[model samples]
Target: MGLFGNFVAGGLAGLAVDLCLFPLDTIKTRLQSEQGFFKAGGFSGIYKGIGSVLSGSIPSAAIFFIVYEGFKAYYSIYPPGSTSEAAVQAIASALGAIAACIVRVPVEVVKQRSQVSLDSTKSSLDVFRETVAKEGYHGLYRGFRITVIRDSLFSLLEFPIWEQMKTFYAVYYGLEKTAPLAGACLGGVAGAISGFLTTPIDVAKTQMMLADSDALATKMGLLQSLVRIGGQGGLPGLFRGAVPRVCWISIGGFIFLGVYDSALTYMSTVAV
Candidate 1:
Protein backbone atom coordinates (compact mmCIF):
# COMPACT_ATOMS: atom_id res chain seq x y z
CA MET A 1 0.00 0.00 0.00
CA GLY A 2 1.01 3.61 -0.52
CA LEU A 3 2.14 5.95 2.26
CA PHE A 4 -1.22 7.71 2.46
CA GLY A 5 -3.04 4.42 2.77
CA ASN A 6 -0.65 3.32 5.46
CA PHE A 7 -1.23 6.61 7.29
CA VAL A 8 -5.00 6.21 7.22
CA ALA A 9 -4.87 2.60 8.31
CA GLY A 10 -2.52 3.34 11.13
CA GLY A 11 -4.62 6.24 12.35
CA LEU A 12 -7.80 4.25 12.30
CA ALA A 13 -6.14 1.34 14.08
CA GLY A 14 -4.67 3.57 16.73
CA LEU A 15 -7.88 5.47 17.27
CA ALA A 16 -9.83 2.28 17.71
CA VAL A 17 -7.29 0.76 20.06
CA ASP A 18 -6.76 3.82 22.21
CA LEU A 19 -10.44 4.55 22.53
CA CYS A 20 -11.28 0.98 23.41
CA LEU A 21 -8.50 0.49 25.94
CA PHE A 22 -8.15 4.00 27.31
CA PRO A 23 -9.44 3.09 30.73
CA LEU A 24 -6.70 0.54 31.15
CA ASP A 25 -4.18 3.10 29.98
CA THR A 26 -5.49 5.54 32.55
CA ILE A 27 -5.19 2.92 35.26
CA LYS A 28 -1.67 2.21 34.10
CA THR A 29 -0.81 5.89 34.29
CA ARG A 30 -2.36 6.28 37.72
CA LEU A 31 -0.47 3.31 39.06
CA GLN A 32 2.75 4.63 37.58
CA SER A 33 2.25 8.14 38.87
CA GLU A 34 3.64 9.55 42.14
CA GLN A 35 0.54 8.51 44.06
CA GLY A 36 1.65 4.91 43.65
CA PHE A 37 -0.78 1.97 43.57
CA PHE A 38 -3.22 2.29 46.45
CA LYS A 39 -3.64 6.02 46.36
CA ALA A 40 -4.22 6.14 42.61
CA GLY A 41 -7.87 5.19 43.08
CA GLY A 42 -9.86 2.24 41.77
CA PHE A 43 -10.64 0.78 38.33
CA SER A 44 -13.66 3.06 37.98
CA GLY A 45 -11.39 6.03 37.34
CA ILE A 46 -9.63 4.49 34.37
CA TYR A 47 -11.25 6.60 31.68
CA LYS A 48 -10.22 9.96 33.09
CA GLY A 49 -7.96 10.88 30.22
CA ILE A 50 -9.68 9.14 27.35
CA GLY A 51 -10.04 12.35 25.40
CA SER A 52 -6.33 13.10 25.43
CA VAL A 53 -5.45 9.58 24.31
CA LEU A 54 -7.92 9.57 21.45
CA SER A 55 -6.84 12.98 20.24
CA GLY A 56 -3.15 12.19 20.36
CA SER A 57 -3.25 8.60 19.18
CA ILE A 58 -4.82 9.33 15.80
CA PRO A 59 -2.14 11.73 14.55
CA SER A 60 0.71 9.96 16.31
CA ALA A 61 -0.22 6.59 14.85
CA ALA A 62 -0.63 8.07 11.41
CA ILE A 63 2.80 9.70 11.48
CA PHE A 64 4.37 6.55 12.86
CA PHE A 65 2.96 4.23 10.18
CA ILE A 66 3.79 6.67 7.43
CA VAL A 67 7.42 6.64 8.50
CA TYR A 68 7.42 2.99 9.51
CA GLU A 69 6.06 1.66 6.19
CA GLY A 70 8.30 4.00 4.23
CA PHE A 71 11.31 2.78 6.14
CA LYS A 72 10.17 -0.81 5.82
CA ALA A 73 10.24 -0.40 2.05
CA TYR A 74 13.62 1.26 2.22
CA TYR A 75 15.02 -1.55 4.36
CA SER A 76 13.54 -4.29 2.16
CA ILE A 77 16.86 -4.50 0.32
CA TYR A 78 17.81 -7.02 3.01
CA PRO A 79 16.40 -10.37 1.93
CA PRO A 80 13.76 -11.99 4.15
CA GLY A 81 15.71 -15.13 5.02
CA SER A 82 18.80 -13.09 5.91
CA THR A 83 19.64 -12.17 9.53
CA SER A 84 19.71 -8.55 8.43
CA GLU A 85 15.95 -8.56 8.06
CA ALA A 86 15.46 -8.54 11.83
CA ALA A 87 18.07 -5.83 12.20
CA VAL A 88 16.38 -3.77 9.50
CA GLN A 89 12.98 -4.10 11.18
CA ALA A 90 14.42 -3.12 14.52
CA ILE A 91 16.13 -0.10 13.03
CA ALA A 92 13.05 0.97 11.11
CA SER A 93 10.82 0.64 14.18
CA ALA A 94 13.26 2.60 16.29
CA LEU A 95 13.35 5.36 13.71
CA GLY A 96 9.59 5.33 13.35
CA ALA A 97 9.18 5.56 17.14
CA ILE A 98 11.53 8.49 17.34
CA ALA A 99 9.63 10.23 14.57
CA ALA A 100 6.34 9.49 16.27
CA CYS A 101 7.64 11.05 19.48
CA ILE A 102 7.72 14.45 17.79
CA VAL A 103 3.96 14.50 18.23
CA ARG A 104 3.56 11.95 21.02
CA VAL A 105 5.52 13.73 23.75
CA PRO A 106 3.25 16.74 24.07
CA VAL A 107 0.13 14.62 23.89
CA GLU A 108 1.50 12.28 26.53
CA VAL A 109 2.40 15.12 28.82
CA VAL A 110 -1.11 16.49 28.70
CA LYS A 111 -2.64 13.05 28.90
CA GLN A 112 -0.74 11.94 31.98
CA ARG A 113 -1.43 15.14 33.82
CA SER A 114 -5.05 14.93 32.95
CA GLN A 115 -5.25 11.32 33.98
CA VAL A 116 -3.72 11.95 37.38
CA SER A 117 -5.94 14.84 38.20
CA LEU A 118 -9.04 14.50 40.41
CA ASP A 119 -11.03 16.71 38.12
CA SER A 120 -12.85 14.62 35.55
CA THR A 121 -14.56 17.69 34.16
CA LYS A 122 -11.40 19.24 32.78
CA SER A 123 -10.94 18.92 29.04
CA SER A 124 -7.68 18.02 27.31
CA LEU A 125 -7.41 21.61 26.10
CA ASP A 126 -7.66 22.73 29.69
CA VAL A 127 -4.73 20.56 30.64
CA PHE A 128 -2.71 21.67 27.62
CA ARG A 129 -3.21 25.34 28.27
CA GLU A 130 -2.48 24.91 31.95
CA THR A 131 0.74 23.11 31.19
CA VAL A 132 1.82 25.73 28.69
CA ALA A 133 0.94 28.58 31.01
CA LYS A 134 2.63 27.01 34.00
CA GLU A 135 5.82 25.76 32.34
CA GLY A 136 5.96 27.31 28.88
CA TYR A 137 5.64 25.51 25.56
CA HIS A 138 8.49 23.18 26.45
CA GLY A 139 6.40 21.89 29.33
CA LEU A 140 4.33 19.97 26.82
CA TYR A 141 7.41 17.85 26.12
CA ARG A 142 8.52 17.21 29.68
CA GLY A 143 9.40 13.57 29.26
CA PHE A 144 10.31 13.70 25.59
CA ARG A 145 13.54 11.74 25.96
CA ILE A 146 12.07 8.95 28.04
CA THR A 147 8.96 8.84 25.85
CA VAL A 148 11.20 8.16 22.87
CA ILE A 149 13.15 5.58 24.83
CA ARG A 150 10.01 3.73 25.96
CA ASP A 151 8.30 3.75 22.54
CA SER A 152 11.54 2.85 20.76
CA LEU A 153 11.79 -0.31 22.81
CA PHE A 154 8.10 -0.96 22.29
CA SER A 155 8.24 -0.80 18.48
CA LEU A 156 11.63 -2.48 18.42
CA LEU A 157 10.12 -5.53 20.05
CA GLU A 158 6.59 -5.36 18.62
CA PHE A 159 7.23 -4.97 14.87
CA PRO A 160 10.05 -7.46 14.63
CA ILE A 161 8.16 -10.11 16.59
CA TRP A 162 5.00 -9.56 14.55
CA GLU A 163 6.88 -9.95 11.27
CA GLN A 164 8.99 -12.87 12.44
CA MET A 165 6.03 -14.72 13.86
CA LYS A 166 4.08 -14.23 10.65
CA THR A 167 7.02 -15.63 8.73
CA PHE A 168 7.21 -18.59 11.07
CA TYR A 169 3.51 -19.32 10.78
CA ALA A 170 3.41 -19.01 7.03
CA VAL A 171 6.61 -20.91 6.31
CA TYR A 172 6.16 -23.69 8.85
CA TYR A 173 2.38 -23.99 9.20
CA GLY A 174 1.35 -22.91 5.69
CA LEU A 175 -1.00 -20.24 7.05
CA GLU A 176 -2.58 -18.19 4.31
CA LYS A 177 -2.20 -14.41 3.98
CA THR A 178 -5.91 -14.01 4.63
CA ALA A 179 -5.51 -15.17 8.22
CA PRO A 180 -5.66 -11.81 9.92
CA LEU A 181 -6.52 -13.59 13.16
CA ALA A 182 -3.06 -15.12 13.14
CA GLY A 183 -1.58 -11.69 12.66
CA ALA A 184 -3.66 -10.38 15.55
CA CYS A 185 -2.49 -13.15 17.82
CA LEU A 186 1.13 -12.54 16.95
CA GLY A 187 0.74 -8.81 17.43
CA GLY A 188 -0.96 -9.30 20.80
CA VAL A 189 1.86 -11.50 22.02
CA ALA A 190 4.47 -9.04 20.82
CA GLY A 191 2.71 -6.14 22.49
CA ALA A 192 2.26 -8.06 25.72
CA ILE A 193 5.92 -8.96 25.84
CA SER A 194 7.05 -5.46 25.03
CA GLY A 195 4.57 -3.89 27.46
CA PHE A 196 5.67 -6.19 30.28
CA LEU A 197 9.34 -5.54 29.74
CA THR A 198 8.97 -1.79 29.38
CA THR A 199 6.76 -1.13 32.41
CA PRO A 200 9.59 0.28 34.51
CA ILE A 201 10.54 2.84 31.93
CA ASP A 202 6.86 3.60 31.54
CA VAL A 203 6.63 4.20 35.28
CA ALA A 204 9.44 6.69 35.16
CA LYS A 205 7.98 8.39 32.09
CA THR A 206 4.62 8.82 33.79
CA GLN A 207 6.20 10.22 36.95
CA MET A 208 8.37 12.62 35.01
CA MET A 209 5.44 13.90 32.99
CA LEU A 210 3.31 14.44 36.06
CA ALA A 211 6.04 16.38 37.80
CA ASP A 212 5.33 20.07 38.02
CA SER A 213 7.59 22.88 36.87
CA ASP A 214 8.78 23.41 40.42
CA ALA A 215 9.13 19.70 40.92
CA LEU A 216 11.16 19.52 37.75
CA ALA A 217 13.94 21.20 39.67
CA THR A 218 14.17 18.10 41.86
CA LYS A 219 13.07 15.62 39.23
CA MET A 220 14.89 12.34 39.05
CA GLY A 221 16.57 11.02 35.96
CA LEU A 222 15.52 7.61 34.63
CA LEU A 223 17.75 5.51 36.85
CA GLN A 224 17.02 7.56 39.92
CA SER A 225 13.31 7.38 39.28
CA LEU A 226 13.48 3.61 38.90
CA VAL A 227 15.44 3.34 42.10
CA ARG A 228 12.89 5.47 43.94
CA ILE A 229 10.06 3.37 42.67
CA GLY A 230 11.94 0.25 43.61
CA GLY A 231 12.34 1.62 47.11
CA GLN A 232 8.58 2.10 47.27
CA GLY A 233 7.66 -1.57 46.79
CA GLY A 234 10.70 -3.40 45.55
CA LEU A 235 10.50 -5.04 42.07
CA PRO A 236 6.72 -4.80 41.97
CA GLY A 237 6.90 -1.07 42.48
CA LEU A 238 8.96 -0.79 39.34
CA PHE A 239 6.40 -2.80 37.43
CA ARG A 240 3.43 -0.94 38.97
CA GLY A 241 0.40 -1.56 36.77
CA ALA A 242 2.05 -4.01 34.42
CA VAL A 243 -0.95 -6.34 34.33
CA PRO A 244 -3.37 -3.75 33.00
CA ARG A 245 -0.73 -2.42 30.63
CA VAL A 246 -0.14 -5.85 29.16
CA CYS A 247 -3.85 -6.43 28.79
CA TRP A 248 -4.48 -3.06 27.20
CA ILE A 249 -1.53 -3.10 24.84
CA SER A 250 -2.09 -6.73 23.92
CA ILE A 251 -5.62 -6.05 22.76
CA GLY A 252 -4.60 -2.77 21.21
CA GLY A 253 -1.81 -4.44 19.29
CA PHE A 254 -4.23 -7.08 18.07
CA ILE A 255 -6.52 -4.39 16.71
CA PHE A 256 -3.67 -2.28 15.36
CA LEU A 257 -1.92 -5.02 13.40
CA GLY A 258 -5.12 -6.70 12.33
CA VAL A 259 -6.61 -3.50 10.96
CA TYR A 260 -3.38 -2.16 9.56
CA ASP A 261 -2.61 -5.34 7.64
CA SER A 262 -6.19 -5.77 6.51
CA ALA A 263 -6.34 -2.18 5.31
CA LEU A 264 -3.08 -2.49 3.43
CA THR A 265 -4.22 -5.71 1.80
CA TYR A 266 -7.47 -4.13 0.68
CA MET A 267 -5.65 -1.08 -0.57
CA SER A 268 -3.20 -3.19 -2.55
CA THR A 269 -6.13 -4.92 -4.21
CA VAL A 270 -7.80 -1.64 -5.04
CA ALA A 271 -4.59 -0.30 -6.53
CA VAL A 272 -4.27 -3.30 -8.78
Candidate 2:
Protein backbone atom coordinates (compact mmCIF):
# COMPACT_ATOMS: atom_id res chain seq x y z
CA MET A 1 0.00 0.00 0.00
CA GLY A 2 1.00 3.61 -0.47
CA LEU A 3 2.03 5.92 2.39
CA PHE A 4 -1.36 7.56 2.62
CA GLY A 5 -3.10 4.23 2.77
CA ASN A 6 -0.78 3.11 5.50
CA PHE A 7 -1.53 6.27 7.42
CA VAL A 8 -5.26 5.79 7.23
CA ALA A 9 -5.29 2.08 7.92
CA GLY A 10 -2.79 2.38 10.71
CA GLY A 11 -4.76 5.20 12.26
CA LEU A 12 -8.01 3.29 12.15
CA ALA A 13 -6.47 0.10 13.45
CA GLY A 14 -4.63 1.92 16.18
CA LEU A 15 -7.67 3.91 17.14
CA ALA A 16 -9.77 0.78 17.39
CA VAL A 17 -7.17 -1.04 19.41
CA ASP A 18 -6.51 1.78 21.86
CA LEU A 19 -10.12 2.70 22.30
CA CYS A 20 -11.03 -0.90 23.03
CA LEU A 21 -8.13 -1.53 25.39
CA PHE A 22 -7.40 1.87 26.89
CA PRO A 23 -8.55 0.79 30.31
CA LEU A 24 -5.87 -1.85 30.32
CA ASP A 25 -3.28 0.71 29.31
CA THR A 26 -4.44 2.97 32.10
CA ILE A 27 -4.10 0.05 34.47
CA LYS A 28 -0.64 -0.67 33.19
CA THR A 29 0.35 2.92 33.69
CA ARG A 30 -1.02 2.98 37.21
CA LEU A 31 0.63 -0.31 37.97
CA GLN A 32 3.93 1.15 36.88
CA SER A 33 3.19 4.49 38.45
CA GLU A 34 4.95 5.78 41.57
CA GLN A 35 1.56 6.15 43.21
CA GLY A 36 1.63 2.44 43.97
CA PHE A 37 -1.09 0.12 42.72
CA PHE A 38 -3.58 0.56 45.56
CA LYS A 39 -3.41 4.33 45.50
CA ALA A 40 -3.41 4.52 41.71
CA GLY A 41 -7.15 4.05 41.56
CA GLY A 42 -8.86 0.69 41.26
CA PHE A 43 -10.99 -0.96 38.54
CA SER A 44 -13.09 2.07 37.70
CA GLY A 45 -9.96 4.20 37.71
CA ILE A 46 -8.63 2.28 34.74
CA TYR A 47 -10.64 4.43 32.39
CA LYS A 48 -9.52 7.74 33.83
CA GLY A 49 -7.36 8.99 31.01
CA ILE A 50 -8.98 7.11 28.17
CA GLY A 51 -10.00 10.21 26.33
CA SER A 52 -6.46 11.47 26.23
CA VAL A 53 -5.24 8.12 25.08
CA LEU A 54 -7.67 8.02 22.15
CA SER A 55 -6.91 11.54 21.10
CA GLY A 56 -3.26 10.70 20.89
CA SER A 57 -3.38 7.10 19.68
CA ILE A 58 -5.03 7.72 16.31
CA PRO A 59 -2.59 10.32 15.05
CA SER A 60 0.35 8.66 16.73
CA ALA A 61 -0.40 5.32 15.10
CA ALA A 62 -1.08 6.84 11.73
CA ILE A 63 2.27 8.59 11.80
CA PHE A 64 3.98 5.41 12.96
CA PHE A 65 2.65 3.23 10.10
CA ILE A 66 3.26 5.92 7.57
CA VAL A 67 6.93 5.86 8.48
CA TYR A 68 7.01 2.11 9.03
CA GLU A 69 5.32 1.17 5.76
CA GLY A 70 7.23 3.76 3.78
CA PHE A 71 10.49 2.38 5.07
CA LYS A 72 9.30 -1.18 4.59
CA ALA A 73 8.51 -0.46 0.95
CA TYR A 74 11.79 1.29 0.42
CA TYR A 75 13.61 -1.64 2.00
CA SER A 76 11.63 -4.34 0.24
CA ILE A 77 14.41 -4.99 -2.28
CA TYR A 78 15.25 -8.27 -0.55
CA PRO A 79 13.54 -11.12 -2.35
CA PRO A 80 10.53 -12.78 -0.79
CA GLY A 81 11.41 -15.79 1.41
CA SER A 82 14.95 -14.44 1.67
CA THR A 83 16.81 -14.93 4.96
CA SER A 84 17.12 -11.15 5.31
CA GLU A 85 13.40 -10.48 5.50
CA ALA A 86 13.26 -10.38 9.29
CA ALA A 87 16.33 -8.20 9.49
CA VAL A 88 14.92 -5.80 6.90
CA GLN A 89 11.65 -5.56 8.81
CA ALA A 90 13.49 -4.96 12.06
CA ILE A 91 15.42 -2.08 10.56
CA ALA A 92 12.30 -0.56 9.08
CA SER A 93 10.37 -0.92 12.32
CA ALA A 94 13.12 0.71 14.32
CA LEU A 95 13.32 3.60 11.90
CA GLY A 96 9.58 4.05 11.97
CA ALA A 97 9.60 4.05 15.78
CA ILE A 98 12.16 6.82 15.83
CA ALA A 99 9.94 8.97 13.67
CA ALA A 100 6.88 7.98 15.70
CA CYS A 101 8.55 9.23 18.87
CA ILE A 102 8.07 12.81 17.75
CA VAL A 103 4.30 12.56 18.13
CA ARG A 104 4.08 9.81 20.73
CA VAL A 105 6.12 11.44 23.47
CA PRO A 106 3.78 14.38 23.96
CA VAL A 107 0.68 12.25 23.79
CA GLU A 108 2.11 9.89 26.36
CA VAL A 109 2.93 12.75 28.70
CA VAL A 110 -0.58 14.12 28.53
CA LYS A 111 -2.24 10.73 28.78
CA GLN A 112 -0.16 9.67 31.72
CA ARG A 113 -0.59 12.91 33.53
CA SER A 114 -4.30 12.82 33.02
CA GLN A 115 -4.48 9.27 34.26
CA VAL A 116 -2.69 10.07 37.47
CA SER A 117 -4.36 13.34 38.22
CA LEU A 118 -5.76 13.54 41.74
CA ASP A 119 -8.78 15.52 40.64
CA SER A 120 -9.87 12.69 38.31
CA THR A 121 -12.18 15.02 36.44
CA LYS A 122 -9.79 16.70 34.03
CA SER A 123 -10.17 16.12 30.31
CA SER A 124 -7.39 15.31 27.89
CA LEU A 125 -7.29 18.85 26.58
CA ASP A 126 -7.27 20.19 30.13
CA VAL A 127 -4.26 18.09 31.01
CA PHE A 128 -2.54 19.03 27.76
CA ARG A 129 -3.03 22.75 28.22
CA GLU A 130 -2.04 22.55 31.88
CA THR A 131 1.13 20.72 30.99
CA VAL A 132 1.99 23.27 28.33
CA ALA A 133 1.31 26.17 30.63
CA LYS A 134 3.16 24.68 33.57
CA GLU A 135 6.18 23.30 31.76
CA GLY A 136 6.25 25.23 28.55
CA TYR A 137 6.36 23.38 25.24
CA HIS A 138 9.06 21.07 26.54
CA GLY A 139 6.71 19.87 29.26
CA LEU A 140 4.82 17.85 26.73
CA TYR A 141 8.04 16.16 25.66
CA ARG A 142 9.27 15.07 29.03
CA GLY A 143 10.92 11.69 28.96
CA PHE A 144 11.51 11.83 25.21
CA ARG A 145 14.74 9.87 25.44
CA ILE A 146 13.33 6.98 27.43
CA THR A 147 10.18 6.97 25.32
CA VAL A 148 12.31 6.56 22.21
CA ILE A 149 14.17 3.72 23.83
CA ARG A 150 11.03 1.90 24.98
CA ASP A 151 9.08 2.30 21.72
CA SER A 152 12.07 1.53 19.51
CA LEU A 153 12.76 -1.62 21.44
CA PHE A 154 9.08 -2.58 21.26
CA SER A 155 9.06 -2.14 17.46
CA LEU A 156 12.38 -3.88 17.09
CA LEU A 157 11.17 -6.96 18.95
CA GLU A 158 7.52 -6.96 17.83
CA PHE A 159 7.87 -6.51 14.06
CA PRO A 160 10.70 -9.00 13.58
CA ILE A 161 9.04 -11.72 15.62
CA TRP A 162 5.69 -11.07 13.96
CA GLU A 163 7.13 -11.17 10.44
CA GLN A 164 9.09 -14.31 11.19
CA MET A 165 6.02 -15.99 12.59
CA LYS A 166 3.99 -15.10 9.52
CA THR A 167 6.76 -16.54 7.39
CA PHE A 168 6.69 -19.71 9.41
CA TYR A 169 2.95 -20.04 9.00
CA ALA A 170 3.17 -19.46 5.26
CA VAL A 171 5.91 -22.03 4.81
CA TYR A 172 4.47 -24.69 7.07
CA TYR A 173 0.82 -24.27 6.12
CA GLY A 174 1.60 -23.82 2.40
CA LEU A 175 -0.48 -20.69 2.33
CA GLU A 176 0.18 -17.79 0.00
CA LYS A 177 0.29 -15.54 3.05
CA THR A 178 -0.81 -15.58 6.64
CA ALA A 179 -4.55 -15.88 7.11
CA PRO A 180 -6.06 -13.14 9.31
CA LEU A 181 -6.38 -15.49 12.27
CA ALA A 182 -2.78 -16.57 11.89
CA GLY A 183 -1.66 -12.96 11.76
CA ALA A 184 -3.69 -12.02 14.85
CA CYS A 185 -2.43 -14.94 16.89
CA LEU A 186 1.17 -14.41 15.96
CA GLY A 187 0.86 -10.70 16.49
CA GLY A 188 -0.43 -11.31 20.03
CA VAL A 189 2.49 -13.59 20.73
CA ALA A 190 4.92 -11.01 19.41
CA GLY A 191 3.33 -8.21 21.39
CA ALA A 192 3.44 -10.24 24.58
CA ILE A 193 7.13 -10.86 24.19
CA SER A 194 7.89 -7.27 23.32
CA GLY A 195 5.78 -5.92 26.19
CA PHE A 196 7.48 -8.16 28.73
CA LEU A 197 10.96 -7.31 27.57
CA THR A 198 10.24 -3.58 27.54
CA THR A 199 8.37 -3.28 30.82
CA PRO A 200 11.39 -2.12 32.76
CA ILE A 201 12.05 0.61 30.26
CA ASP A 202 8.37 1.43 30.32
CA VAL A 203 8.51 1.75 34.08
CA ALA A 204 11.28 4.25 33.89
CA LYS A 205 9.62 6.21 31.10
CA THR A 206 6.35 6.45 32.99
CA GLN A 207 8.00 7.52 36.19
CA MET A 208 9.88 10.21 34.38
CA MET A 209 6.82 11.42 32.51
CA LEU A 210 4.69 11.44 35.63
CA ALA A 211 7.33 13.23 37.56
CA ASP A 212 6.40 16.64 38.95
CA SER A 213 7.44 19.34 36.54
CA ASP A 214 6.83 21.94 39.22
CA ALA A 215 10.20 21.25 40.72
CA LEU A 216 12.84 19.79 38.44
CA ALA A 217 13.16 17.25 41.26
CA THR A 218 12.30 14.32 39.06
CA LYS A 219 14.41 15.30 36.11
CA MET A 220 16.45 12.18 36.45
CA GLY A 221 17.85 10.48 33.38
CA LEU A 222 17.12 6.87 32.37
CA LEU A 223 19.82 5.33 34.51
CA GLN A 224 18.87 7.51 37.43
CA SER A 225 15.22 6.60 37.06
CA LEU A 226 16.05 2.91 36.96
CA VAL A 227 18.18 3.28 40.06
CA ARG A 228 15.41 5.17 41.84
CA ILE A 229 12.92 2.49 40.89
CA GLY A 230 15.26 -0.17 42.14
CA GLY A 231 15.55 1.71 45.40
CA GLN A 232 11.80 1.66 45.78
CA GLY A 233 11.43 -2.13 45.69
CA GLY A 234 14.56 -3.63 44.24
CA LEU A 235 14.42 -5.30 40.78
CA PRO A 236 10.80 -6.42 41.23
CA GLY A 237 9.75 -2.80 41.40
CA LEU A 238 10.94 -2.33 37.84
CA PHE A 239 8.33 -4.75 36.52
CA ARG A 240 5.41 -3.69 38.66
CA GLY A 241 2.71 -4.24 36.11
CA ALA A 242 3.91 -7.11 33.97
CA VAL A 243 0.62 -9.01 34.01
CA PRO A 244 -1.66 -6.18 32.90
CA ARG A 245 0.94 -4.86 30.50
CA VAL A 246 1.35 -8.18 28.76
CA CYS A 247 -2.36 -8.83 28.63
CA TRP A 248 -3.21 -5.43 27.22
CA ILE A 249 -0.39 -5.39 24.71
CA SER A 250 -1.16 -8.91 23.54
CA ILE A 251 -4.78 -8.00 22.89
CA GLY A 252 -3.83 -4.66 21.39
CA GLY A 253 -1.38 -6.29 19.02
CA PHE A 254 -4.01 -8.71 17.87
CA ILE A 255 -6.50 -5.97 17.12
CA PHE A 256 -4.03 -3.47 15.71
CA LEU A 257 -2.29 -5.85 13.32
CA GLY A 258 -5.45 -7.74 12.48
CA VAL A 259 -7.20 -4.59 11.39
CA TYR A 260 -4.06 -3.28 9.74
CA ASP A 261 -3.45 -6.39 7.65
CA SER A 262 -7.13 -6.59 6.77
CA ALA A 263 -7.15 -2.98 5.66
CA LEU A 264 -4.05 -3.43 3.56
CA THR A 265 -5.52 -6.49 1.95
CA TYR A 266 -8.71 -4.62 1.13
CA MET A 267 -6.72 -1.74 -0.29
CA SER A 268 -4.66 -4.04 -2.46
CA THR A 269 -7.78 -5.70 -3.83
CA VAL A 270 -9.35 -2.37 -4.54
CA ALA A 271 -6.26 -1.22 -6.36
CA VAL A 272 -6.30 -4.37 -8.47
The window of 10 residues in a row where model 1 has the poorest summed lDDT is 36-45
Q: Which lDDT tens digits does candidate 1 get at residues 162-264?
A: 8888887887876555377789889999999999999999988888888767784137777887788788779988888899999999998999898888877
Best by TM-score: 2
TM-score of each: 0.94, 0.95
User: Candidate 2 at residue 266, lDDT?
Assistant: 89
lDDT of 2 by residue, 235-265 (tens): 8998888898999999999999999998888
Clashes of 1: 0
Q: In candidate 1, which residue pairs get closer than 3 Å at backbone N, Cα or C atoms, i.e. clash?
A: none
lDDT of each: 0.83, 0.85
Instruction: Please list the residue runs of candidate 1 whose C-alpha ends up more than 4 Å from where it truly belongs after superposition.
Output: 175-178, 216-218
lDDT for 159 in candidate 1 is: 89
Return the TM-score for candidate 1, rounded to 2 decimals: 0.94
